[model samples]
Target: MIESAFPIVEVPDMEAALRFYRDALGATVVYRFPPDGEPLFATLQAGSAQLGLGLAEGATAGEGAGMLLWFYVDDVDATTRALSDAGYLVLEEPSDSEWGERVALVSDPFGTRVRLGQPIAPQPDEE
Candidate 1:
């Protein structure tokens, strides 16, 4: 039984990435390595979602590719609009999906793509 999963995003600049996660995505830094010194690694929380940010070197070198982080919210449209207002890049506008979800895609300042989704209630069967 898995307890929890934390997605780690490696970035070239840790401070800038931290700012984007904290200010743009509303994530709070829960823990940081070297507490008093510069943070090379840190954990953040937004509600129940936990995320890890680290320097892009050594084992973590490379851009966020072939991975799409999904953040589920109450209102996909509202969140998308808010993100747009904040100057984030909207990769895909909010829209209904055939799989019964309202979803939108956006990219962080560092090119990390994230998908925001809200589950749609199932409709009554047609007679």
Candidate 2:
């Protein structure tokens, strides 16, 4: 059984990526390497979700990844609209799914898929 996990994105530009996650997503820098100097690695916290940003050596952000990062939000529609309005690429518009979720997908400048989802209550069963 998995205990806990956090997604890490390797970025070519640390400062820019930091701003994107921080300002756009409202993540706060919880930890950083070399606390006093240039940040090569850092951890960001937005509610319960934590994202790690590390300086990319050879691999770029979201390069050759088979998994998509999902973020659970309180309001999928509002969050999707806000992110899209801020110039992020919207891969999927907010829509209701058969699985009882309202979901939307957007990509960062580096092509990282950020999926926002809000759970919807199930309908009553037929008699």
Candidate 3:
């Protein structure tokens, strides 16, 4: 049986990741490896979702594992804009998708691609 599952990403700077995630997404620091000083690994929780950040040794920003992170936000456009204003690169603008979501693409502080979306409410049928 599986107890829990979450994505743990390697980051060039733990503090940078912490600031971005915490400030932008309102994530809270659930735990840290050392609990003091500079931690090598930290886990954050935002809503029901959890993300882990591991300090990458001898690695520069944007050098970690290449993977696209997806998140379901309350407002895709607003969230994307905040991230972009915070210096994250905007890859795509928010638009409605055929899959019933308003989706947008942006890069995190470490240059990792992040996809944010919110389900679009169904429209009423007109006679």
Best by TM-score: 3
Tens digit of lDDT per residue, candidate 1, span 57-80?
A: 533322456777888878889888
Question: What TM-score against the true fold does each predicted structure earn?
Answer: 0.79, 0.82, 0.84
Candidate 3, residues 23-115, lDDT tens digits: the string is: 786789999999889999999887788999899965543435568778888999999888888888888999998767899988777777778
| Candidate 2 lDDT tens digits, 7-54 | 888887788788678877778999999798889999999788788999
Taking all chains together, the TM-score of candidate 2 against the true structure is 0.82
Q: Show pairs that collide, candidate 1.
A: none
Candidate 3 backbone collisions, by pair: none
TM-score of 3: 0.84
Query: Residue 93, candidate 2: how far off, in angstroms?
Result: 0.6
Stronger candidate by lDDT (1 vs 2): 2
lDDT of each: 0.80, 0.81, 0.82
* lDDT score at residue 94, model 2, on the 0-100 scale: 94
C-alpha RMSD values across all candidates: 3.3, 2.7, 3.1
Error of 2 at 106 (Å): 0.5
Model 1: lDDT of residue 28: 94
